[model samples]
Target chain A: MSETDLKLPLDAWHRAQGARMVSFARYEMPIQYEGIIAEHRWTRESAGLFDVSHMGQLVIAGRDAEWGLEALLPADLAILKDGRLRYSLLLREDAGIIDDLMVTRRGDHFYMVVNGATKHGDIDHMRTTLPSGVVLDHMTQQALLALQGPKAVDVMARVAPGAEELTFMTGGGFDIGGVRAWISRSGYTGEDGFEISVEARNVGDVAALLVAQPEVKPIGLGARDSLRLEAGLPLYGHDLDETTTPVEADLTFALSKRRRESGGFPGVQRILTELDKGPIRKRVGLFVEGRQPVREGALVVDAEGSEVGKVTSGGFSPTLERPIAMAYVPAAAAVPGTEILVEQRGKIFKAEVAQMPFVPHRYHRKGASA
Target chain B: MSVYFTKDHEWVRVDGDTGTVGITDYAQGQLGDIVFVEVPEAGRQVDKGGDSAVVESVKAASDIYAPVGGEVIEGNAALADEPSLVNTDPEGEGWFFKMRIADPSELDGLMDADAYRAFLADQ
Candidate 1:
C-alpha cells in the first residue's frame, strides 16, 4: 500500500484471507480473493460478501432538507416514502452528471450514499448548494458491507431473522448479534441481497458472522466490477462522468414523473429537452461475436471504419459465456440488433447492440415470489 | 532441448532451430483468470522484445513479448476455446506458439531456470 492510500476497517482481515490488494479511490482494496471469475460465479450461485466501506454515507437533516436536496438532484425527494431507497443522480448546472447516488428516506432525515471516488467533491457541492438550515453529516464512523447472491436472503435470515421482510430497495434499522445495523435489500449485482451499515468497531463481527454461513464467501472488487458490468449497471468514472448527462447515460428512469413535469432541478430545460426529443448519443449494450473481450476505451466503428463512440465497460460474462460490453453510440445505432464494430489493439471484431441487464435481475420486490 | 526464460516472464524451449514459447507460471498467476489469448499468425516475423501475443484477464490485458526474434510457426488453437489452459497447464499443453528461431546466438543471452528464479526473487 502507498503512504497516501487509506485502508478499510477489514483491510487486515482481507490480507489474512489472501486477497490480492489494489489501489482504488485512494484506498487499498481487495481486488480478488480466490479469483475474479470464481468469485463472480459464486456470487451468482451462492452468497458473496463484499466490504464496501469506502463508499461515503451521509445524513441530511433539518427542515426543508428534502426541498433543498431536490434543487440539485433530478429525483422528487419530497414524495419518497420513509424507509424506501431511490437511485438518483447529482446533476451539474449544465445537466451533466456529478455523481450517481442512492438516497433513502429515514422518516425525519435522508440517508445518502455516494460513490467513493467522488464523495468529497459531492459533499463540497452539497454543502455549497444547500440552505443554511439543512445539515450535512458525513457518517465516517460507519462501515458498509454487501451480502449478495441467490442465497443472500437465506443467510441474512439465518443471522437476523426478520431481515427477509425487507423487500428490494427497502431498509430499516435492525439488530444483529446485539450490534445495531441498518440494512437495505439492495445491491449492485443483479441479485437479491442486502447492504448493511454497521458501526465501524463492530463491522468485523458482522462480517465474520455472515461469512461463517456455508453459503457465503468473501468476494473482492474484481468480481464486484464484473458483476455490475454483467448486470448493465454503469461504473461512475467509466460509464458516467461530468461530461455525460443522465439521458445520454440511459438513466432517465431515475428522473421522477413529477420532476419531469414540473422541472425545477438544475439544467431542467436541457434535461427535459433531451428526455422529450431523445439524446444524440445513447448508452447501449454490445454483444461481441467471439470469445475475445472488447475492453473499455475500445473504439466503436461503423462499416466504413469511422469511429462513432467508445466503449465504457466491457468484460467476459461468466454467466453468458461470451464477451459483453456497454458503450455509447449514435441514436440510430442504439437499437437492438444494429451491427457495429469494436476496434481494440489494432484488431476489429463484429458487435451488435443488445438490450441490457444482459442477465435478468432477480430483485426480491414486494409481493414477488422468493 | 533446453528451456530459457526472459525477464518479462516468458519461456522458450529450443528443440533444434524451432523454439516453442509461452508465458511463465508466475506470469499467469499474476494475471488471474485468463479469458482470452491473441497469438501472432504463423509466418509473421517478430523482433526481440517486440509484442508477440496478448493475454487478457477479466480485469486487464497484457502484451506477451517475444524473448528473441523469430518467425511464427503455429499458435495453439485450443486456446481459442479454452484460454484458462494457460493458467492450468502453462508449460505443457498451454504453450502459446512455435517459432523458427531467427538467430541461435539470441538464446545465449536468455536466463536458465535458476537465474530466472533469482530474477523473480529480486523483483
Candidate 2:
C-alpha cells in the first residue's frame, strides 16, 4: 500500500479474512475474499456484508436546507418525506449529471450519500452552490456497511430487532450491540437489504457481529460491482459522468413530476426539452449472444458498421449465467428487442437491446407481496 | 517429456517437436473464476510472445500469450463449455492448445521449473 492510500476501519479485519486488497478511490479496499463469482452467488442466495465506508456520507443542515438543495439537484427535495430516501442526481448547469446520490429527509436535516470517487467534488459543489445559511457537513467520522440479500431482513432483525420494521428506502436510528447506527432498508444490489451507518470507532465491532451469523459473509468490491451490474445499476465514473444527462442516462424517474413542471433546477431547459422530444441517445441493457463478455468501452455499431454508441458497463452475470452490458445507443436503436452489434478487439459480436434490471428488483416494500 | 514456463506465466509440456500449452496455476489463481476461453484455430501460425488465446473472468478479460513460436495443431474443445477447468486443473486438462514447434531453439530460451518459480517470487 502507498502512503497516500487510505484504510477503512475494517481494513485489518478484511486482511485477516484473506481479502485481496486493491486501491479503490484512494483506499486500500478488499476486492475479493475467496472469489468474485462465489461471493456474488452467496449474496444473491443469502446475505452478504459489504464494507462501503469509502462512500461519502454528508448532512445538509440549517433552516432552508431542503429548498437550498433543490436549487442544485433536479429532484423535488421539499416533497421528500421524513425517514424516506430518494435516489437523486447532482447536476451541472448544462443538464449533465455531476453524481448520482441517495438523499434521505431526516426530519430536521437531509442526509445524503455520494459516490466515493466524486464525494469531495460533490461536497465542494454543494458548499459553493447552496446559500450561506445552508451548511454541508462531511460525515467523515462515520463508516457505512451494507447487509444485502434476500435474507438480509432476517439477519438485521436478529441483530438490531426494530430494523426489520423499516421497509425499503426508509431509515432510522437504531442500537446494535450498544453502538448507535442509522440503518436504512436500501442497497445498490437489486435485493432486499439494509445499509447501516455507524461511528468509525464502532464499525469494526458491528461488522464482526454481522458476519458471525451463518447467513452473512464478508463480500468485497468485486462481488459488489457484479451484483450492481446484474441489477442494471450504473457505476458513477463508468455508466454516468458530467457529459451524460439524466434523460440520456434513462434516469428521468429521478426528476419528480412536480419538479418537471415547475422547472426550477439547473439544466431545466435542456432536460425539459429532452423530456418532451426524447433524448437523442438512450442508455439500455444488452443481452450478448455468446458466452464471451462484451466489456465496457466496446463500440455499439449499426447495420452499416458505423459507430452509434459505446458500452458503459459490462460483465458476466453470476446469477443469470451469461454476459450482460449497458450501453448508450441512438434512441431509435434503444428498443428492448432491437438488434445491435458490439465490437471488441476487432471482432463483432451479436447483441440485443434488453430491458434493465436484467434480474427483477426484489425490494422489501411495505404492503407488497413477497 | 519436460515442461517449460514463460515469464508471462504460460507453460508448455514439450514432447519431441510437439508441445501442449496452458497457463500456470499461479495465473489461474489470480484470474479467480474463468468464464470463457477463446483459443486460436488449428493451423494458425503463432510467433513467440504473440496473442494466442483470450481468458475471461467475471471481472475482466486477459490475453494469453504464446510462450514460443509454433504452428497451432489443436485448440482445446472442452474449454468451450467448461472454462472453469482452467481453474480446477490448469496444467493438465486445462491445456489451451497443442502446437508443432517451429524452432526448437525457442525452448532453450524459456525458463525451467526452478527458474520460473524464482521469477514468480520476483514478481
Candidate 3:
C-alpha cells in the first residue's frame, strides 16, 4: 500500500487496463481489472487470464533433488512422472503446514511454485534442511500467468497450438505468441485451464496472445480469490497457515501412500497419527444461510455464545449467489449437515456444514468430459 | 426540500423535520456492486456521524455512518432483494431509511451540494 511497494512485471500494463492496484506480498498487484463480480461471472462462463507473477517459481536440481524434496514434503514425489504436476505441502516439525505448493518434474529439474508471501521463508527452510547435493534456484525473472475457465483450453490452443494436448496437471515447454514459456494444464480455479511460466521481459507478448482470443479477458486478484473460494481451494495465508496441519485442513489426500508408510518427512509420525485417530479440529465448508456475508475473524459460537472455532476465509460467492465460508471447527461439528452458528459484529448467522467444491469442478480429465 | 452531505459520503435529503438518508452515488460507485445492505429499523435512534448502516461489497464491508442524528421511521426493505439499486439509483430508490430529524441545526454543520462536489474533487 505504500510508495515503496515493488511493482509487478505488468504494473504499467495493469494500470493501462484500468485495474485497481493493491499491495500484496510486498508487490503491487491488480486486485480487479474491470469489476470483481463481472470478471468472476465472465471467467465461469468463458476464459480469464490472470497475472500471477508474484508467486515464487523455484527450480531444484542436481544429484538428489527428488529425494531432497520428498524428505521435506508429504507428497509421494518418487512416483511423480516427468512433465506432471502434483499438489504438495511443506510441513513443520510438528506436522503443521509451512505452505501449500505445486511441484512439477520437468526433465532433469523439479520446478516448485510457492505462495508469494512465504516464498523467502520457504526457500530459507529448504536451503537449511535439504541435502548439500541438491540446488535450489529462485527464478525471480520468470513471470506466471494462468488462463482459467470453461473455455480456457480453447484459448490456450489458440495461443500455443499443441498446449491443449496436455491434460490436467501436465506441462511442457511451448512457444506461445512467439515467446517461449513452460505451459501447463493446471490452475487454481477448479476448471479446465493452464498456467504459463515465461520470462518476465517476454510475458507481455504471452499475455496479449491469450487475451486476444475472443473467449479470454484479463482477470484480477479479486476475482481470482472468489473463483478459488467457490472452487473450495484453500488459500495459503487465509485457510492454510503455520498453525494448521494437513490432516486438520482435510488435505490428507496430498499425503501420498508411500510417504505415509515410509515416514521420512518432517512431522511424519504426528501427521500419520492424526490421520488414523482423526484430528481434533477439521476444516469444513459452510453454506452461509443468508444474503448478508459473514467475513473472516467471525467467531463460530456455540448456543451459549462461547467461541468454539474461527472463520478463516469467508465471502460472498458470486456464482452461487449466496455467502459461503470455510472454518476449522471441532471434528464433531464438521459433518456435512451440522448446523454452524456464526457470529459477526453482534449479529448471528445460521450456517450449515457443507461438502466442499461448492461449485462442481469441471476439470478436463483424460476419459471424462469437461 | 434540499440535500446535505456528510464527509463520509452519506446524503440526507431533508424536508422539514423528516429526512431520507442513503449513501451518495459517488460512494456507491467507489464501493462497486454492493451485495448486502443493513438498513436501520424503525424506532432506532442514531447520533450524527455514528456508524449506523452496513453496506457490503463482494470484496469488503463498509459502514454507512448517519449523516445527522435522527430517529428511524422506516427501513428500506426493498434493498433486501435488490441491493444493486444502490449502484443503479443511489440517490433515489436506493435510499436506506426515513428518519425524523433530531435537530434541524445539525444540517447547518453539513455541506450543501456545491460544497460536497468540491469536497469530492479535493479527495
Please report, as a residue range, the 10-residue window in candidate 2 chain A with the lowest summed lDDT: A72-81
Q: In model 3, what is the error at residue A166, expressed in angstroms?
A: 0.8
Give per-residue CA lDDT, model 1, range A207-240, as digits (tens). Answer: 8898889999999999999899889999999999
Model 3, position B46, has a per-residue lDDT of 94
**Interface DockQ per candidate:** 0.87, 0.92, 0.83
* Models sorted by lDDT, best on top: 2, 1, 3
Q: Give candidate 1 regions above 4 Å deviation.
A: none
Q: How much TM-score does chain B earn in each model?
A: 0.98, 0.97, 0.98
Q: Candidate 2 residues A1-370, lDDT tens each? A: 6789999988999999999999999899999999999999999999999999999999999998988899988887877889999999999889999999999999799999999989999999999999999999999999999999998988988899899999899999999878899999999989999999999999999999999999999999999999999898999999999999999999989999999989789999999999999999999999999899999999998778889999999989998899999999999998999999999999999999999899988999989976
For model 1, what is the alpha-carbon lDDT of residue A294?
A: 90
Model 2, docking class: high
Q: Candidate 3: misplaced stretches above 4 Å?
A: none
- Which tens-of-lDDT digit does each residue in B1-123 have in candidate 2? 999999889999999999899999999999999999998899999999999999999889999999889899999999999999999999999999999999999888899999999999998
Interface RMSD of 3: 0.7
lDDT digits (tens) for residues B11-121 of candidate 1: 999999999999999999999999999888999998889999999998889999998898999999999988999999999889899999999899899999999999999
lDDT of 1: 0.93
Q: How close is candidate 2 to the true structure, as a TM-score?
A: 0.99
lDDT of 3 by residue, A255-337 (tens): 89888888899988888889889999999999999798888889999999999998998889999999999999999998999
